[model samples]
Target: MITAAVLAALAMACAMGAWRLTFAKWPWRAPRAAILLWQSLGVTWGLASVGALLAYALEPYGGGVVYGLHAFVDSAVSFGTGHGLLKPYDLPRVSALIAGLTLLAVLVTVLLAAGVQTLRARRRHRVLLALIAHEDPGVPGVRVVDHPGAAAYCLPGLMGSEVVVSAGTLSLLHPDELTAVLAHEAAHARERHDLVLLPFTALNWALPWLSVVRNAHSSVALLVEMAADDRARRYCSPRRLATALLRFGTAGAVPAPDGALGASGEHVMARVNRLVKPGPTFPRHARVSVITFSILLSASAPLLWIYPA
Candidate 1:
């Protein structure tokens, strides 16, 4: 019975995580703060799922299954009754210890997951920033560095990567259009899209079975780009930006560095399409729904413990 409950809980947690990650409306326009929150929830859900899986594996009837097994076990082990898994004499100390250990485990898991990722990101940022600083010279506010590659990239940090606009790209875009391109790259650096993406990417890599996480990551990626585009539009004419996107699409300049933010090859067409046909405004209700769902999912494990089935 414990095993069945654990499995059901695991399934529920996974489903909930998936939905929270992937079900956003107007995903591209979502605020940076909101994306951060979504990624945090995803990490929390993944952690809870891991805990539930551990519980399931440790449960008895490890290799056997029976219908209504969980209910039977729960009935047989009713906590206040003499027939329960914890007898009156065993209840106090054992239950207290188990509860204490579970709390500790949860704390350790959250810290480990978040700490490891934070440390790695800090290390990578330090290394990447030093490399970019050494390689590129700059002008205040905005300056373009010439690099001989098929790649377009914006390095973003305290000492951000010099916006590397390839020579081929200069010929492809008109002057005002080029400004839009630069603005887009600047927006990426300013918003720190890479940092925002880190947790979601980690979740996707860690929990590949959750297709919803991958979808969420993809959606977030697309949205971040759009959000950057919107920022670019604020400085440059949207028509010029749209034209630049078209030209860049035609020029086929690939994105530089696995880590840099730019309209990478994979999503160039989608981006151009969006530029040409921008979507309707994101609704407040959609944001509320997404946030509400995330809150419920994040609370699920604790809720289950409080009101055990």
Candidate 2:
């Protein structure tokens, strides 16, 4: 049974990882649309994992490490009493101490990781602001910074929103192309893609072993970029957006900070491919199947948690 449980957990982990990589690599015509798809997948995966964990924990031999620790503590206490190292009155104190230490260890680890990520984000934001302030001056309501490579981005923040472009990027494209690029970044800011990614970001930090969470994040990021591209397309031509993306991508510019939207290497070929030959629309039946799958997954959560293995 234990072997079965271990294998099940391993399978779930592997499946999630594979899906994450697959979706992350899939090309999309619109980045924002891709992001939404990834978000849906991430949410579903997270819910399923949590449900499975709960189910496993409920089994007789479940809660593996935690239960083992508890049993070990109890045995140790009993042994100590038999050997005269501990008094009967001290039993409660020892148990409380063990539980408290365990809980503290877990909490501290989580908090420390969260704090590090927060600090890194803040530092990146500060550097971005300084870069923007120095490079693009006197642009009202938008601040543009310069990267060493070719790219454009908008970093959405509470008080210091910024738009960034690279020197190589400025030299590579025409004014119309730049406009389309800027518009895409603006769309990302307006739509709050960063906020949308927060949940998955937290998951990635908390559960780094689950590569699915990271894949979901990258996929969603690419999708959000594409979605912004789609919005830009409404204002400009697809050709213009495509041109900008290609030029920026080829220039080899690294994207801006964590929150900004910029062209990524992973999706560059896919984006170009999308521009050249878009796929046919999904049939009604396919759409229905997708919706049905989502609903069924959601409805199965409770059942997954309660059913005996």
* Number of the top TM-score candidate: 2
Please give the lDDT score at residue 59 for candidate 1: 37
lDDT of 1 by residue, 1-309 (tens): 353365456556566755764665456555553565565465555544444443433234232222123443564578557755531134443353355356546555654575466556555745654454333232334433454433446765555545666655666677787778888888888888877776666656655686776787787787778778888879988778777776666666665554567755456666677767778866778778767766765666554432332
> Quick one: best lDDT, which candidate?
1
Could you give the C-alpha RMSD of every candidate to the true structure, in order shown?
A: 8.8, 7.5
C-alpha lDDT of all candidate models, in order: 0.59, 0.58
TM-score of each: 0.61, 0.62
Output the worst ten-in-a-row residue range by lDDT, candidate 1: 60-69
Candidate 2 lDDT over 1-309, as tens digits, reads 342254346437535644755554333533433444445555545444444443333333234334433544575677777953332135554454355455445445665565567557856876757756455443335454454567666766766456666666667778788777778777877787667766666667776886665776666656666677677777887788788777766677675666455645467766666656677754566556545654554445334433344
